[model samples]
Target: MPDGGLDPVIHAPARLRVVATLAALGPGDELSFPKLQKLLDMTAGNLSTHLRKLEDAGYVHVTKTHEGRTPATYLRLTGAGRAAFEAYTTALTTLLRGTAS
Candidate 1:
């Protein structure tokens, strides 16, 4: 959603849902992988694939650590990500409004 355009990366349906969910969190807040998966109703592999793409695009930050013996993965949107999502929404809204009768 940079340069006043839609982001093909975030435009994908699953990725859009992921970004929307993460965007709902407060800045610097994080969501556990399981929690996000449950929230989005996405299988582990499906979510992982999309997340990997977002991370590669520098829109998502993924952290891996240990909670006792269990491994934990947490996700948050980067500043660029926040900006991109904002732009995406603005563009989408504009597009929709233009089409409204």
Candidate 2:
């Protein structure tokens, strides 16, 4: 994004939902893949695709682990991501208010 513009990386609808959900978590908090999938009501593949994009953008951090015989994925928004989301919201509000007047 350039100068108060919305970030393309965080602007897509599905990705936005994913970011918004993760942003709700407290700092240092993380969510497991299955739990996030349930919260977003998204298919594993769908969520994975979006997650990959966010991860590539340096906006999200992903961790892979094993729980007994099972594999688990955990996700959290990074500091840059939180900052970007905050900027996005502020820009969106400004845009909306501009049209309202």
Candidate 3:
């Protein structure tokens, strides 16, 4: 939980999970759509919809490319996304700290 309630912009379940996963990866790291779908245990369509939402909010970057004869999609978090995620974590930490007193 966070103070003043979680920011809806980052509080969305799918979006929150997406940001958490991205935060766990290395810098300049990226994940493929299929890989992410598997990791999140979500349907392709479901994951696609979530990803689109994140992309629209400038929280994630989606890249579509061709790999020989096949299509490849990569997802990564933007700088703004990273900052927001960090803030979310910090808020959660602060809230927990208050409870620990």
Candidate 4:
């Protein structure tokens, strides 16, 4: 009714980028922290903050493990996250097409 309302949580620029990156991964696939940081061109602390927000919202699943004594962080989108992203895209498309519903 409001031109396909946008998701406040995913509307932030940083959060949008994070969600988009995660959405690009194949189903059940994950991206490493360093990879994400490089891809997004974000600082380690900045990326970590955004990840924490997404994780807190249950939109992301994070796994921390050791790879040859090096800590590795992996991030994946949850089913709920995938669904929310889909809806967000749909709403954006609808708004862009000037079809407000």
Q: Pairs clashing in candidate 3?
A: none
Output the lDDT of residue 80, model 4. Answer: 82
1-101 per-residue lDDT for model 4 (tens digits) = 24368777777799899999999998789999999999999999998898888888888999999999899999999888888889889899988999875
lDDT of 2 by residue, 31-89 (tens): 99999999999999999999999999899999999999999999999999999899899
Question: Tens-digit lDDT track for model 3 on 1-101?
Answer: 44444556778788788889987887568999989888999899988888888788787888999999999999999887888888887777867778533
**Considering summed lDDT, which 10 consecutive residues are worst modelled in model 2?**
92-101
Off by over 4 Å in 4: 1-3
lDDT of 2: 0.92
TM-score of 2: 0.92
Per-prediction TM-score to the true structure, in the order listed:
0.92, 0.92, 0.85, 0.92
Question: What is the Cα root-mean-square deviation between model 4 and the actual structure?
Answer: 1.8
Arrange candidates by TM-score, descending.
Answer: 2, 1, 4, 3
Candidate 1, position 34, lDDT: 100
Colliding residue pairs in candidate 1: none
lDDT of candidate 1 vs native?
0.92
The deviation in Å at residue 26 for candidate 2 is 0.6
